[model samples]
Each structure stands twice: as C-alpha cells, then as structure tokens.
Target: MRRIATAVAAALALGLLLPWAMPATAASAPPAAAAFRQEVPRTILALVDLREEDTIRLSRIHTMVELPLNHLGLSVVYWNVADGLPDLSRYPGLRGVVTWFAGEPFADAAAYIDWVGRAMDRGVRFAVLGQPGVRLERGGRPVPLALANRFFARFGLRDDDGFSDLTYRSKPALADGTIGFERTLSGVLPGYPLFRKTDARVSSHLVMRRADDPASDSHLVVTGPAGGLAAEGYDRYFDAEYNRRQWIVDPFAFFRNAFATDDLPKPDVTTLSGRRIYFSHIDGDGWRNVTEVTPHAAKRVLSADMVRIAAIEPFPDLPVTVAPIVGDLDPTWNGTPQSVEAAKTLFALPQVEPASHTWTHPFQWIFFKDYSRQKEAPFLDRDGTYRPTKSDDHAAETAGEVSDIGRYAVPRAYLQQPFDLDQEIGGALDYFTRLAPAGKRAVLVQWSGDTSPFEDALAAVRKTGGVNMNGGDARFDADFPSITGLPPVGLPVGTERQIYAAGSNENTYTDLWTNRFYGYRNLVNTMRHAGAPIRLKPFNVYYHMYSGQKAASLNALVSVLTAARATELAPVAASIYARIAEGFYTARFEPLEGGRRWRVRDRGALNTLRFDRASATAVDFTRSTGVLGQRHSQGSLYVALDPAVAEPVVALAEIDRADRDPPAPVPYLVEGRWAFSALAGEGTGEGAGFRVAATGYGEGAMVWRVPRPGPWTITAERDGAVLWTGSATADDDGRLALTVPLSGIDPLILRLRPILRPSGGAAG
Candidate 1:
C-alpha cells in the first residue's frame, strides 16, 4: 500500500542509461556501443515526496506506468525517499539513480542540486520534486538554490528566474466553461516517455507567464500559443504558500512506465496469480443508509473486462455463511424474537446468509463514548440504576448482547464487531467464545473508519481465527440507510451517493435498505485478481428491518441479487456443505471390493459426516479395546453385526447411578425374532450400500441404526501383541446386530473385526 514515489522518479530518470552499461551477457541489451557513440547517459532520476501530498492519486500513477515501462524495457526505480533510499548496489545494472528527499521544512534547492550532481558523477542520475522556490538541505542546513536552479534549467529548460513553460489542459471538458488553469507543472516530472501513451488522460492549459520576467519566454518548457506561463495560475504564486502540497499526477501511469522500462527490472507478475481477495463490510455505524448501495455501485464499477468477481461474505456472526450476497445483522437492535422473525421474513430471503455485525454495532463504546447517562444504556448499573461506565463495562455489555442473540438464532456464528486495541479484541474474543456453542468457530469483522484505523484493525484481525477486512470506495456516514431502499428526495447526479441509488435498484427482494451493498461484481473481480476461490456468501445488508414498508425497497433487494447472478457476479455453484461432501467422497474415502472403508486420514479429529449411512456407528478405535454396548439411558456404541448372520438378539441392560458407585446388571429378555435380510447382491459394489438390522431387542430401547456401511477395524494391540479381537459383518442390506454382556466391565469395548473380501465374497 505504501508507494516508493521518490524511488520511482529516480528510476525513471536513470533507466535511460542502463542499456549502454549492461554486461555482455545481458539479454535485453544489445552489445555496448563505442565510447564516444555511447550516450552521456544524462539519466534524470527523480523521487517525489508524497507523504504530505495526495497519496491516493499518487498511487494511481504508480499502477499506470508499471506495464508500459516493462514493455519499453527502460530502466527505472521509484523510491518513496521519505524512508531513505535502498542500497544502490542491489541494482548493479542500473547506471544512474534518482531519489525524492522528503521531510519537514522542505529541502534547499542548492543542496539538492549538488547532491544530484554528485550522484550523477558517481554513475547515478538524480532529480528533486518540490515547489519551484523550495530550498534543499543537507544535515539540517540550507543548500544554495542557485546551483540546483542552474542544473535543472538545462533539463527543465527554465530561464534565469527558475520557471518552466510546461502547462497542462483538460482533455475532457468539465461542465463549467473554465477550460483549464495556466499553472506551472510542479512536483512529478512529466518528461519521462512512460507517460507518453498512458491510459490516464491529462490535458494542459495555456502557459500564462514566465518566472524570471513576465514578458520573456525563458522559463517556459512548452508554452501554449495563446496562453503563456503566468503567476496567476501558478501554485507558488498564491498568497498562502502551500509547502507540502503535491501535484496530482497519474501514479498508475508512473508505475506502469517504471516497470516496463529497462531501468528497473520487471517484477514477477506471476506472484499475484491465483491469489484470492476478500472484501467485507466494515463501516458498522457510519453509512448505514448507503451500505446496500455501496455494494451495488462497486459491482457496477468493477464489472468490466479483465476483472473477475470473487466471493463476498458478510462480516461473521450473522445468520448466514457465505451466501452469494450477504447482509449484516446488527446485534445492537433490541428487538424481540417476534420482531427478529418479522425482519427476517421481510428483509432476508432463503438464499441470503445473515452475518452478525456485533452486539449493537458498538461504535460509541468502542470510540470511547459515555453511554451510562442514556436510558437504554449499554452498561448495567450496580443497584439496577443505569449509570455510565467505560472500556471494560462497555465490553461486558457488548458480550452480553452477543449471548442474548445466540439464544434465538441457531445459525448465527460469525461475529463482525469493532475494537480499538489488543485488549478490546481479546475481550471480545473471550466473550464470544464463551457465548458460542461448543462446535462453532468465531470470525472477526474489522470496522475501519479511515486508512489508519483500517490498517490498525487489519493487524488485529489477522491475529484472530477468522478475521477479514472490507475494501471499497464508499465513504462512511451514519445517517444514511444501510443500503438505499429508495433514493432520497433530492440527490445530485454524478455524486457517489447518486451512483449507489441508481445501482441499488438492480436487486429486487428486499429494498436496498440496509445500506450494505455487496459490490458483488467488484468483490468477485478483486478476489479473482487475488487468486482466491469463488466461494461467496450472499451480501447481508441490514437495517432497522421495520424502517419502511415501501414496495420500492423490497423490489430493490430482489433486483440487486437477480442482477448480480445474471452478470455472473453470483454464480449458482455448490454450497459449502456440498463442497465439503465432495471433498470427503472424492479425496478422503477409498473404494474397496465389497464395501468401502470410511477411514479418516485428516489431521483434525473432528469432521462432518456427509453421506448418511444406514446401520454403522463411528467408533473411536484409538480409545477402547472392545465394541461399546448400547445402554438404555445414553446413546450407545457397539460393533455392527451382519443381520444376515445374527438374529433373535436380546437387549443388554447396564445401569449406573450418578452418585452411587455402581449398579447390578439386569438381563432383558428377547421379545420375539423379527426377520431382517438383505439380497446378496444389494449394496455391495466398489462403492455401494450395506444394511444392518436388530429385530429381537426389547421394546424399551430406541431403534438403533447405522447411517452407512463400510469395513471398520477396531483393535487393542500393544507392542505387537493382540489383547482382544472381535468381528462384526455388514450384510448386503448394510445391517449389523450384536449384543454385549454388561456383567464384568463398567466401561467395556468389544472390538469389531475388519472384513476383507471382494465386492461380494467371504467375510472375516
């Protein structure tokens, strides 16, 4: 995210000299020319200090030049000189260097010129980017401006007064009549060939006046015929001096050029291949109205050629898990079950996945606001009197809200919350972990208000289990609906807000009311660029749920989802459950002759059972020696017997008291034999079926059944010695019935022997 602006500039200037000095074996360079024929290599490397300037626009330029520079095979490097230059030796192939010196109070022109000249003399090219009259310095002392001015005048074509005639005009006319401003081009130098055929369009206005003399053309670089360079349009000529202001240039163009040129070796483009990009909604409280609109607008802007849409999910702890479009379920709402149900019915469709946006989107508490004085205070009072509290109290209150939500919503597992510091994150995690069910994992959604906060929150989220951050251009504001249900009364065109409104109507289920839009297309494209999988959750944009009953809003939601799918932004692919099942069957399970074995080779102890089997029980072979018997009070464990072989089985009863040491064993009588059979050919292929049945058991026990049948092996062997072994076979019907004696062992295991045979052969 950080741009090496100064390095880029210097690299561009010095890149011109690389080919001549290349070694004989260099691939891109021709044989070195004769000494005199060899160009002096006046590489004018320049580094632009963007720390105090419009960094966003500067970065755009960086992206732009990256491709073209590589295409041209020009040597170039753009360093963000604020952090100081890197070791020049690393780039031995580069003949010259340019650096953009950055700091407070600006560098003196004289000192900068001397430094550049010295660098040039040592086979390095250098240029400084700053205001025209700015001074350069070394070791905190002023350097003479005369020397720098003199050197720059040659390349810049400036007059004695230190000004160039170069000027820019707008290619596309603005709505207003004003064509362009006659300003001296400062900051980023535009002479580099990298900008010649850039996609980013930049036009210039006529030059107005010269720096040295008002009437003379000495200081002008490229004066327009009608308007000449003048002080009126110049940035430096203003009454209030702008010291750290930077000239807006195409950064994308700059980097595109830097990379294509021979100056700086091209980076490995493949590094970014197959990487996935994930974008979530982070503006919890702010821009609630625009949330829905934001996603739609993002999809619209990014749904162009060369862009692939990645999967987009809502922040965690909501109602859904990676639906095509997800919406944020704000836990802050104090609505009851009926209210929540009503909201879900109206706002959420079956396809949507609802993610939690923390307990009450606690912006105020996280931002350190006083909430105790309010009647509906987040924190509780000592004597039931609601008084205000700070950090810890607020965190506890938030955690309570999470617990309250879990009582009703069984599917809500992801938690999208805001936290400022490490302690806050730790507190939220601790609270959520306790509140979540035993099998669930917690995911954190970071709420970053600005760049700095976003970076900070990102660092914290990475440390957690399932934390992800969102990215887009939507500005955060609290008053707007989470997603624009309907356009406001009077909104201007061409504004970002209006764009959201226009795109918000694309989906038509619930109105784009939540202000949380998926930017479905954009999310996908970024994800594809990042080489991430295309598994996306529905965009879960939420609001008060009962804010409006307008038909427009409902239609907006439907339209958004429908449009997203239509444009391939949201594909109808396999669900997470389906994919997990596929993985198990295709990768995990192995096919055997008669019946397949459901052996778990995964490193994790826990895994979801995909296919439902008929009569087998998954036994933990690592713990017990013999097959576990079924008990009347609790779920039973046992070895399955082939119903074809076993019949008239009696139920074995084992009684154990909670407080008492043990209970006497009672044998239950078999009522009557019920015939359970399977065809010899049925459920018995390479990957086929099996069944088991227990017909003669007593009436009190719950019916025991196996979900599926596969060869299972249970052994209790130590040091190459077998302690005990028992065998149970699943028939073609996939049924196994067996009864274990409950007399001697309080906890006993009867080993189930693994059967080895062809698809339809003998069993062991």
Candidate 2:
C-alpha cells in the first residue's frame, strides 16, 4: 500500500493524472452512472465456474437472456460458484441469483448453503436454466433424487414429474404443460443459404424440460416452454454451426421468439436499446418484395417498434448532375425517394434514420479530386463561382464512374482522380439533411465498397458526430455450416469484409461479388451463417439492392434474422452501430501508476466498465458528463457514459497514468491522396511515396501541396489515347490539383517529361 501511494504521488507530480481524476464538482460522470445512484440494482448475481465447455454453454445462456434482461433493465454480476460461493454482502440490492448448474460437485458446501439461506431470508430469489437436477414427486410421492435437488427442496415448489421426454411448443396458449405462455414470432430473409424453403420457412429447433411441470417461482420472469419443428431436418437439438449435440433450445431462434413475445423476465439492467442506427445501400434490388417488403418491414416496425429497424441511405447526389443513363431522382440511380409516405411514416415513428451514399455515388476514390489545370471544369463547365463540381453524365457511366451493379465479378479499386471532399461526403450529407425530415437526419456515410476514404472526409463526418460503418464484416457460409466460425477477435465491425461466395450462380461485376442461390443453397447459407451466433460479432450485412429483389435471396435474409432472434442477436441502430462496433476494437482497461484509465473506442456493451473505485469521480470525454459509482458487491465501479462518443476520458476514476503511448497502426495515408508504401514484386517502397504492380493492383496519387502561378500541362489517358489534357494558369489563387482515374486494363501514371516553366521558377 505504501509503495502504491508513493508511486501514485510521484505520477501526479509528473502530471499523469487524466482529466477524469478530478472530483465530481470538476466534471461529471456519464448519465448511466447517474441512473445507478437512484435505484436499487436492477441486477442479478450470476454464479459460474467458467471451465472449458462451461464457457461456451454459459456464453450461449447469456446470449439467450440478453434481450429479455435488457428489456427488463436487469444486469447480472457474475460470481464463480465453482470453488465455493464468494461474498455477496456487497450486492444486497441485487434482485436475484441465477445459474445454469447441473449440480457440479463443489467445495465448501456449507458456506454455499449458508449464503443461499441468507440470500433467501433477504428475499433474494434463485433460478436456474433448464432442470439443473431437481427432485420430483409423483402424485405426492417422492420419486428419485437428482442433481441440484437441494435447490428445489429448499424452495418447496413440488413438481409431480421428473425430467421427462416432453415437447413444449412456443405457440399461443397451446398448453404443453410448462409455466406461462409465449407466442412464437417468425419471419423470412431471402438472401442467405440456409432455410427450409418448402416445409419449415421459419428456422426452428428443440427444447428439453420436465413433463407437466408448473412455474417454480411466482413472478419468475422466465417460463421456458419451447416446441419442436414439424420439419424433419431440424428436429434434433443440433448446433448446426459446430455440429455439437445436446439437450437445449435452438439458441438462435429462441431469442427472436423471446423478443417478439416479450416472454422473458422483466429487465433488471439498463440498455441503450433506444440508441440505434440503420445502414443501407441502394445498388438497386428488384421491386418485387423489396417494393413490397420495404413496406412490410416498415409496417411491422410501425406496429411494434421492434428491436430491428431500417434506415434509408440514398445517393442524393445523382439527380443534380448532367443527364445520363440513370438520374439521381430515379429510384434506380438513387438520390430519390423509394416511397415518400414510407419515409414520412418511418420518420414520424422516429424509427427511420437517413444516411448519405454521396450524390453521384461514383467509385468515390478519385471523383472528389480537384484537377490542377482542370480544377475549374465542373464549375466552369457546369456552374459558376466555387461550388463543388457535379460529375458529368459520363462520370456516372464509365469504368471509373459510379458503382454499376453486376458490372464486374470481382470489384477492383482504383484511384479517383480530381476528387474533392465537399463534392463527395460533405455535399451529399448537406443535401440529404435538408431533404430528410427534421427528425430523420442521417448519420451513416457509405462508400462504393468502403474503400479508402480520405481522412478529411471522415473528419467532416465526425464533426457531425457520426461514426462511419463503411466495410464488410463477413460473408455467408456455403450450403450450410453446422457450427459457426467466429470472427477474428480484434476485428471491429463494418471494417471487415468476410466473403464466402458459393451458390447456384457466382459472378463478379465491377466492385460487387454476387453469388445468387436457389432453394436448398439458400437454406445452407442460412444455417451456416446462423450456426455460430457467437462468432457474428463486429456486425454489418451489405448487398446490392438488386440481389434482394426476389425471394431467391430474401429467404436467407429471413433465416439469418430468425436465427439472430433465437440467438439473441440485436441489430443495433445505425446511429449507434458504428460506436458499438468500434467499441470492441477500442475499449480498454489500463493500469496506471495511481489509478486506471478505462476507455472504449466505441460505445461499450452495458456494464462493460467495472472498476474498483467506489468513491472515485469519473468524467467521459466521448459525450457524457458521466455517472460515477460502484456496484455494491466487491466495490465494482461501472460508469454510465454515452455510447460511441470518442475520447471519453475518465478522471479521478483512474489510479494514475504511466504516460505510455500505445503502438501506432501501420502507416497509411491520412489524406485522400494515395501514396504507395509497397509493390508486389519490388518488395517495400524503401521510403518511395508510391508503388505500382505489373497487374495494376495498387495505390497511386498525383497531388501537389504548394501553388504555382502559371499555366500547367496535364494529361489523362485511358488507353493509347489521352482521355483528358489541358493547360491553364492557376485560377486566382495559383493552386493546382489532380486525381488518377481507377481502371482495369492499364495503370494510369503521371509522367515527368515536360512542364516548361519560364525563367528561373522551379517546376514542382
């Protein structure tokens, strides 16, 4: 203790205390913490052993309970009951204790018994998942002893039947002899590979329980009564992702039914449930159900304000440009309304959020550029003054133009020449915000393929306080996967594009990799994607609007979501998705000299922050003033700050900082200008600014920093012929700019041979 104090004092002398170290009067904790101050804990104590198989099983159990608990504003504080019961005096306010125990023989039985007795006296209830080995009485006669019998014996809730081969169907009051009633909710997604197209369209599974049992505890929030699928293929309890077998409910679909029926226990934890975001890209889907289902999804959302919702992200920049094959106002080209009334209804429900897909929706890389000699063309040729230039109709049609769906099988990236920040992200965002309902402001900024966006464009987005969900997270599995494959732990959501291309038809057009499937193939992908629900972290799903045009694709969509529901997968709102996704990557617990610095790069999961400073004051730099307090048990401190706001610094909440900087990410361009760091065969660039591959797969940029006061010769060639070339003096300010167009056949290069500058002026 003396050593710790001395070190803390020394660190303080060195100015290592973060801003959050100040007292509450200096700054406030986040709102979440403030809420904690006013209530008895809407929390439960979770006892676990956390051994091998238990980890996976426990994780699934948590997933199953997430929605119900979250809805009821309840949290669980885990205690390792494996060795023996830990002290719980600190958590006296906890509403109850729960475990998924089959009576794992434990040590210090006496102490556990005493703890349970005390807890029961304090009115702290007890619950378990499944049967957990309880003694059953048949016709008031004691049958046989089973594991965890002490628990049921103490509760005095007699059950006439022991664990039996019983099936509980999740239907509307169709009695199967279980406690309580919960109706099943089902839906369909047509794009995935797994789903029973002919027989069982709804993803279904099994559950195990005692025959003819009654509710064990009164006001017990959970009453498990599940059903078997009528379909033959999905009858048994198989974790299709891993091919594991056991007696349990279909983990994925169960949560969906739970959320839909509101059938689980009331929440004892607080949730950012209302804080949401929706991400959509319009590459043009068929109007069949998309036109119909768009309204259907909307109508479903309108009626119940379900946990899942949709927000439109149209390419509003298209219409204002020159006439072309597709116009901005045309639903096909985006930048237009799919349905004004739908938009109004969504906006009114405060359920819809709008995002920007740029005006022209060009390849996005080079289109925002300012051409040195040609910088004045968009304004000169299209308009006057200094407004950002709109891409010509040709810009919307060619190789380096807008993203044309099904244009290429494997989407190749290229440098967008003559690009500008204002034209791409800024202008689009501005235009849409004006057109959007006052309540439906957009927060998502999507790119053609989440290619390298300029740092400036990103900054402009952040200034509006929005996180960019701009990348692919994963691809669907083929035919079917019995087990789910987990995503790389460190990967952040939306930043990963995990692709698995298999189905009836697989093709690549422009930047899109399309794999269209039919009946069985769709079911395969659905089960495979749904198999490992735990592995589906860092979440984001994207497809061209075209693929979802038919039921061929939508089936998988339905299955994936249905699986997500049963597995307790919550589709975060676009408003908060970026933050939540990023949080997995950025959240940290830092040990400091005198204290600790706990920070998450994105909005954190509920109660993710639990420190030991009971009296410490915390302030969040992300967005909240912060609520500072600790849980009663073990002085565990959890902060209540806003989600996803960046730089949420916790003060006084930390012991101290060592003033260490984390290693930086690999060096890459922060600006829109691309500089090559390496080449395929040449190895590293050795400090050279750019590298080009023989196959023309690389990054290149032609950007100038300082302005020169003179006309300049500039040329851009597609093949053997020059696509564009011009000479003009720097307009007014003497600044020059350029963008390299992205293409497939040959690499575009800016050459040196001839800029004849007069006199002694140096050619930069």
Best by lDDT: 2
Q: For residues 1-764, write the lDDT of model 2, one tens digit per residue.
A: 01111222332333321232245642354534423232333455667655523542235334343323332334445665545566777774565666554344344444455567677676666654532323222123332433233433344322333322222422222222222112122222011111111222222132222232322111111222221111111112334686543322342333323222222112111112111111222221121122123545544222111112322212110110010112233353332343333333333432234555554444434334433525335333243222222233112222222233334211222122244455556665555555555644555565543334544556666676654543322233442222222212211112232111111111121123324432322433533443232222322334333333334444544443343333322233343434444343333322222233333333343323433223333322322222211121122233333222233334333323222111111111111222111111111222112112111111222322122334455554433456545543433333334444442113232321224445534344
Predicted structure 1: lDDT: 0.26
- What's every prediction's RMSD, in angstroms? 25.3, 25.1
Positional deviation of 633 in candidate 1, in angstroms? 65
Model 1 lDDT per residue over 1-764, tens place:
00111222222332212111113432232223211132212122335456644442233123222222222222234444455544555544444443333344344555444544555455453322223323434345544545534554323333343333342321111111112222234443222210011111222322333233334332211212111111212211122352222223222123222222222211111110011111112122211111122344443221100011111222111122221111222234222232233223322322222222343333322233222233233333344322322242122222222222223221111223222345344444444444343423334443322111223433454466334322222211121211111211111111111001111111121222233332222332322222212111222232222111223433433343343333211111111222221222122221111222222222111111211111223322222111111211112112221112111111122333322111211111111111111211112333332221211111111122232344533332222345444444444333444433221101111223335466644443
* Residue ranges of candidate 2 with Cα displaced over 4 Å: 1-327, 330-349, 364-420, 476-541, 582-764
What global local distance difference test value does model 2 have? 0.32
Error of 1 at 138 (Å): 12
Output the lDDT of residue 100, model 2: 53
